[model samples]
Target chain A: MNTITHYSDEIINAFVDGELAAAERRELLAAAAESDRLRQRICEAVQLKELVRGAYPARSPEGLVKGRSGRRGARMRHAAAAAVAVLAVSVALLLPRPEPGQRLADGALSPVLPLSTGEEAGETTRVVFHVSSADPAAARELLDQVELVLREYAAGNRPLKVEVIANNEGLRLLQQGRSPVAERIRRLDQRYQNLLFAACGNTLERLRRETGEQIRILPQAVIVQSGVSFVARRQQEGWAYIKV
Target chain B: MKTMRPYTPFLLLLSLLLAAPLAFAGSDDGPKHKIVIQVSSDDARTQKIALNNAVNLQKALGQDNVAIEIVAYGPGLSLLTSKSRQGKRVESLAMQDITFSACGNTMKKVARKTGKEPQLLEGVRVVQAGVLRIMELQEQGYAYVRP
Candidate 1:
C-alpha cells in the first residue's frame, strides 16, 4: 500500500464526484499515479455512494394500493418508474426562473412590501429602495413616494435606514447635485438621517455615457458599483426590498 | 421549584449548543475566506468540482457566513444549460442554495454568432459575464478562488 498525499475536502469531493477539470484531473491523476491504492479509494467512495442510494427502496408501500392483488405490485413498480421518467423530462424542460439574489446590488427585481403590510412598527428597520427609470419625472415620483412612506413609517417609531439605489435610468436621480427632486430628497434625508445618493461608480462608467457627466448627484451622495447588486446583497441579508 | 429544576439543565445545554455555531459562524476574521469558481470550461469534470467546492463552503460555514457565486461565460455558459453536460451539477448546487449566474455578454455574443440564443442551464441566473459577475460578487464581499 502507498501513502496517500494529503487531500483537501474540496479535492476529495471532486474526486468522488469525478468532477476535476482537465488540468486538475490531470494533476490529481499524476499525483495519484504513484498510488493505485489512492485511486481505488476514490473509486470506492463513488461506488459506495451509489450502493447507499440503491440500499434504500425507491418506493414506499404506503403509496401503493394496500390490498391490491399480486399483479398490481409489478404494475405499480412499472408505473412508478414511468412517473419518475416523466418527472425527469418535465424538470429538464423547466427553464430557470430569475429569483433575485440576496444583497442585490445589480438592480435585480425583488419583492417590495407585500400588497398587504404585515408587521406594524416593531422596530426601526433598514430598507433599500431600487429605482431604475429612463424618465426623470417618473424617477422623481418614485422618490417622492418613498419619502412619503418613510415619513409615515417613522411617525409610528419605525425609523428607516433608507438607501436609494439608482441604476440604469434611475441614475438620473443622482445627477451632479441637480436631480429634479434633489431638494425634496435632501430634505427627507436630513430630517431622517437617511442616505440619498447615486451609485457613483456604476453611474459614471455605465450611465455616464448614456446621460453625460453634467447630470448632478447631490453632494451627499456616495457612489458604489452596481446599485442593483448592492441592494440585492442587502435584500439577501433579509432587508425587505421595495422598488418605488 | 421541581418544575424549574427539570427544565434548567436542558435549557442550559440547548443554549450552549445553539450559541456554539454562531460563535464559529459569525467570525469574519478566519481564513482569507474567499472562493471564486470558474465554469468557463464546458468540461463536466471541472464544472462538477467548481460546484462541489461551493457546496462544501456552504456546509462548513452557513451559507450566509460565506458568499458563493458561479460565473459561466463562453463555453462554460453551456454548463448552465438543462441539456448540457453539467446540468445535473447545476441543479444540485441550486438546491443547496448556491447562486449560479450566467454571462449575458456571452449570450449576446454567442447568440449573434450562432444565430440562436445560448441556452442557460435550468437553474442558473443570467448576469453580464462570468468574469464580470465574479468581479461584481467579489466587490459585494465574496472571496474569489478560481477552482
Candidate 2:
C-alpha cells in the first residue's frame, strides 16, 4: 500500500503515455510485477489512455501519402511526417488541460500590495525570503535576520520591500498557535510597514486533505494560491530572492 | 485527383523548404545535454561528491555545451548555507554557471525547530520544492545524478 501510494497519477500517466525513459519504464515495470496494487494502477492508466483516444479519435493521424514522387521528395515528406508526429505527441502528452477550479489567475498568489510599496519610498530594494523548513527555531531566526537586514537599511534611510513566502513544511511557521515564533512574527509585522508574509495555499489544502486538519495561519499571513509561482513572479519583477 | 497532379511538385517543394530548416535546426547547435544532481544528505563527504560530480561533468562536457543544476533539500541544504564550511566552494562553482537551488520546504522545517532560517550562500536560488525542480529538469530531458 505504501509503494502504491508513492505512485502519483502524474507518474502513472507519464508511464502510460510512453513518456518515461527506458530505465524508468523498466523500473516501473519491475515494481508493477511485484505489487498487485501497482499492477492495477498501471492497468487503469492504460484503460484511461484508451478511453481518451477513443473519445478524441480525430486526434489520431491519418495516412498522408497520395502518390509516389521522387526519392528526394519522398525523403522530404518522411521528414515532415516525422516532425508532425513529434509535435502531435508532445502536444498530446505535455499539454494537459486544466481542470475547473484548478486554474489560478495571474498574480492571484501575490500579496494585494507589493511589499516594496509603502509611504517612505526613495528607491525600494525588494527582497523575497523563502522558507520551506518546519523548524520553529529556524523560522524565528530567519525573521530575525530579515529584521536585521531591514534595520540596517532603515539606518541608512533606505526603503525596503520584504516578503516572507512559506510553502510545504515551511507553512508550519505560519500556522496559528502551533508556530513557535507566532508572537515574534506578530510583533515584527506591527513594526515593519513594508514587510509581508505569505503562506502557500496549495500546501494548506494538501495538509487538510491528507491529515483532515484545518490549519489556521497567523492573522498576519496572506494565503497565496501557489508559493512557487509567487516567488517566480517576484523574481521576474527584479526582486532579490533569498531562501532562509 | 487528375487536377491535383500539377500541384504535387509545388507541394513537394514547399514541404522540402519547410522541413529542411526544421531538420537542419537540430544539427546547428547539436544536442544540448543537461543534468540535475540531487543532494539530500547533510554529510560533508556527500556534499563534496556532489560538487566533484558537477566539476567533472563540466570538464567532460564543455561548460557552454552542458547545463548543470544542483538541487539541495532537507539536511543536504547545509551545503548551500552561508554558515556551512562548503559555502565558499558552492559560490565558486556557481561562478562557473552551475545553478544551485535550495528547497524552501526544508528551510522552513529547519527554521521551526531551530527558531532561525539558515542563511543560504549568495547566488543560490530558493525553489518551493527541491524534488519537484529535479522532476522538472528530468522532464526537460536532463539526466538525473545522485552523487
Candidate 3:
C-alpha cells in the first residue's frame, strides 16, 4: 500500500471541486486507494459537496411543468435561480477558507520595515490621538485631552509613547504660521520627546494642487505619506487609538 | 397509499441529509464581539497605534473570531488616502479581514478644499460620517475605540 504523506489541503479541495488536472486526479486516486486517511478526506469532501447541493435542491421537472401553467412559470424560474444564487453565496461565506490576497492601491505589496523596536518594543502604555478637525477650538480641546492623559501617566512615571496625527482639515493645526496653537505646539515639542506630531502628505498635495501654493507645516511635525495608513498600521501593532 | 409508507422513512432520511448543511450554515456560534476604532488624526504615530491595536486584537482573538472596523474622518481620513505612507500595510491587513471605513463627509470637505476628490486606498469603504459610523457600530454592539 502506497502512503500519501505529502498532499496539501488546497490540493484536496481542488480535487473535490473537480478542479485538479487529470494527472493530479489520477495520482490522488492512486494514493487514496492505499491510505485510509486520504480516502476518508475524499469521502468527507464528497459528503460536504452533497450536503451543500442538497440544501438547495434543483427544481424538479414536475415543478417546471406545473409552472408552465402561465407567466408565473417564468417568474418561478427566476425566483428559483435567485434562491440558488443566494444559497451559493451563503455556502461560500460559511466555508472555512483563507481569503484571497488583496492588491494594494499601488498595485503591489511593498516591503514594510519592522516598525516596533527600541522604545516602541512592547512598552507598558501607548496612546495615539487623532485630530482631524480644522477648528482651532476643537484642536485645542484635543490637545488638552492629550495633556490631561499624559499628565496622569507622568505623575505615575509610567513609560508612555503618544502620537498626534493631523490630516485633512486637522492639518490646520500643523501649519507653520497659521496654526492657533503654534507656540503651544512648539512648547509641547520642547517639553515632550516621547510625543511625535505627524502631518499628511496627501493633504499637502491637495492643498498645493487646489491653491497653487505650497503649504508649510510646523518644523516639529514629520510628514507621512497618508495619515489613515499610519493610524491603521499603528492599530495593527496594538496601540490605543483616541479620536479627538 | 399503503405502498408509499415504506418509502416515507427513506424520504425523511434524505431530507435530513439535505437539511444538515443548511442548519450548519445558519447556526451562529454566539454573539460576535466587534470593535470600531476611530482615527481622526492624520499623524503617522497615531495611525500606527490604531493599526497596531487592530492587528494585536486579531492576533489575540483569531481573525475569524473578532470583527474590527477602523473609521477615518477629517484629517484622519488621510490614513485611508491612496498615497498614504502605510498604504501597503493597510492593504495587507485589510486582506487579513480588517475593515477600513473612510468618511464621505471628509471626502467632500477635502474635495471642496482641494478641488479634487481625495483618492482612497483600494479596500477602504466610504460611509457618511465617521462619528455616525462609530455610533452605528456601537449601537450594533461593537465596542468603540479611538486610536
Top model number, DockQ: 3
Rank the models by lDDT, top first: 2, 3, 1
> Over the stretch A165-236, how does candidate 2's per-residue lDDT look in tens digits?
999999999898788888988898878766777778779889989999979888777665578877766554
Candidate 1, residues A1-244, lDDT tens digits: the string is 0122123222444555554455556645653543443354456445443533343223222222122221111223467766765554455346353211221223222121111023322333555667776566566545654665566556766544556777776766766454677677667655654444444345557655765655545554554445666665555544545553
User: What TM-scores does chain A show, candidate by candidate in order?
Assistant: 0.45, 0.51, 0.51
Q: Model 3: residues >4 Å from true position, as ranges?
A: A1-119, B1-147
Worst 10 residues of 1 chain B by lDDT: B131-140
Interface RMSD, all candidates in order, equals 13.8, 11.0, 7.6
Q: What DockQ values do the models have? A: 0.01, 0.04, 0.07
Query: lDDT scores for all predictions?
Result: 0.55, 0.68, 0.67
The digit string of per-residue lDDT tens for model 3 on A46-143 reads 65445434443442222222322211111234777667665655664565543211211222221110111123334446666777889987887667
* Fnat across every predicted model, in order: 0.00, 0.00, 0.10
Q: What is the C-alpha RMSD of each candidate to the true structure, in Å?
A: 28.7, 16.9, 24.4
**Alpha carbon deviation, residue A111, candidate 3 (Å):** 28
Which has the better lDDT: candidate 1, or candidate 2?
Answer: 2
